[model samples]
Target: MSAVSAVATDRAQADAAVVVAWCDELADITAEPGRITRVYLSPEHARVNAVVGGWMRDAGLRTWQDAAGNLHGRVDGSTADARTLLLGSHLDTVVDAGRYDGIVGVLMAIRTVARLTAAGPLPSAVEVIAFSDEEGTRFGKALLGSSAVAGVWDDGWWDLEDGDGTTLRRAFTDFGLDPESVGTAAADPSTLIGYLEAHIEQGPYLDRAGQALGVVTSIASARRFSVEAVGEARHAGGTPYERRHDALLAAAEAALAVEGICRASQHIGTVGTMTVEPGAVNVVPGLARFSVDLRGEFDEGRDRVWDAITAAFDEIAVRRGVAVEPTEVHRAPAVFCAPALMDALRTGIVSTGEAAPPALFSRAGHDAMSLGLVTDVGMLFLRNPDGISHHPDEFVAEADIALGLDALAVAVRTLTERHGTGPDGVS
Candidate 1:
């Protein structure tokens, strides 16, 4: 779940009461639709599909669900063999999610289609994809839905299991999908024009800049690790300070070092999970484990930050007389926006009468990262006050959504005008 998974889950673990309520609701899956906690290939997933699919039809698009369970709605262009333009965001959410993180993008997309088709069919066919999984909450693998559409779905992922040990393959069958058909979900790269997604900023940049929208320049290059610090557990009362090798203390310092290093580098790092062994109040903790997520706009800069963080950890471990170990669990390279699409977005925003729209590099991952494999990708971000996302506090002003609808529609038109006659619609 934690691409921002750890962002909320562990960093805000103090919100145990809120977390419990979310878990309880998810236990029933049909639990009265209180707070969003939808995971992949579950009843909650199906429920949203039906609801959103209805809106798709109302927008004058034909709807269907792919083998990987991503929901899609499409309307053809006037020309024969018209290139397809993809628009959308994920429908799935982290536990106790905010209403708009992915939902708004999907809704805006359908509305954008309505605005476009109201005039006439676009030069390129338009398809809106409500990606089934981007949080990787259930199977601990992000981008399952988009990866399938990108034609990069891995068969090995079938064995991935949830907390309850339900393999992804089993979940597919349980959801009434054939695992063998997952490969069919891939969209033909030649036919696709590109993928554009409009999402909440997921950071404070736009809000602070006082801008309603920004053209995303790229998605962060990210790496996630499970880190461990080891020492001997001993009696708290009898052990002298000089003889103590407290692993927990060392891990704590490492966490602080992560913040310090990343802050100075203008990158982002999160030590989201931590656990200390031997729960007794009188026992000196001997084993400490934590999660580290490091991200930056560029790979080299991000990796440099990681090396610096590791060095800081090694120094802390030596000083605390503990051994530090880090195991990498996940990594994604930065996905840059298509220059033409970025320009289209820029023109689209400017068309809305804004002289200058900000250009930002996202620190959070999105469905675009996977879609980047199949086609050029671009993103438009709406302001979220203080960039607090993944929680209930995350928000986008209604006015911003209204403006975004116009902006995205114009952006699509700009794209169509620029590359309508091209085979791939890439300018």
Candidate 2:
């Protein structure tokens, strides 16, 4: 091998070890005593910003915390005419979270920007943003930080309450931030060239394919609903099967129907949460409430499956003699990666002396979905073992992270050079 190739391989290995150590360091700043549970606008949030902000400054970048609580770092380009490229991902984690999910992406970007700056003048000013909230474990509102940056913050989100009954508005104030000033976090769309995020695949595809990285084609379109089944309550023993209208039975059937339809349709659906009313053990359940999370690659196809599921649910409700009602609580359309940015990432993966990387559509929603509202977005994914995530067992190899750092750094440079000299400029 050439001397240059050996040096590059060494750098990837060293950087991977450093980032894995950094992830371990951040995992210790959780609210729970022995688990990872960092949420939005809590003490952990502030502590992490300070910790990562110091690292950002050490990387020769100016750092600051946005009004919405997202931490940011910037390294300027060589020329005044140079464009800006956005990088990085969320810093928050879900309850009892794994070490890599959102954290690895941010650390990878920090190292990428450091590499770019150390190589001398760049054609674009690279900005690394560690968005404060993505998991929404606290307020039950995901992408809060990126939504603010995209200028899509809703006025009604302030009323959202955590499990502890503290209002989001109050939590903001307690975190030493004004609820009204979140608008200041929005970036002008004109200033950004595009957004590129490096994240763990959070699925088994890359590992199964034996690839270290993949380029994201798109983030899934998602819809969520709260479903309820209501029926007459009666004594469990006294009520005959002929006269029974058991809500719990009907709700269970509905949940099963969702699973069946999604499986047959090749879409993803989950009845993640469910509850039944009546405290007495001898009493039949008269009310059952459950949540349905449905996701797919396109809007129309996803909605079609929802239609099929709804029809199946209605049939189950009638057969069981219960009233079924479903309320749509949240919806986000599909976000596709730009072809140009995809090419840049493709170029980067190939630069690592590997074969052309495979492309995959993300089933999990990301902050990239929110950022896509304002600008073009692209993502590169490292392999996650067994596709485990949002759990304590989720894991990624250090060697994969090392490869990710090298790929991401090259992708940023490729993008910057292309955008600077492109025919249209800053697509």
The residue ranges of model 1 lying beyond 4 angstroms of the native Cα positions read 1-33, 424-427
Off by over 4 Å in 2: 1-8, 420-427
> What is candidate 2's TM-score against the reference?
0.96
TM-score of each: 0.91, 0.96
RMSD of 1: 7.9
Point to the candidate with the largest TM-score: 2
How well is each residue in 277-371 modelled by candidate 2, as lDDT tens digits? 88479988999999999999999999999999999888988898999999999999999998888888888887787666889999998999988
Put down candidate 1 lDDT per residue, 292-387, tens digits, no spaces: 999999999999999999999899988999999999999899999999899888877776667788899998999999999889999999889899
RMSD of every prediction: 7.9, 2.5
Candidate 1 positional error at 381, Å? 0.8
- What's the lDDT for candidate 1? 0.84
Clashing pairs in 1: 1-5, 2-5, 203-387
The candidate that achieves the highest lDDT relative to the unseen native structure:
2
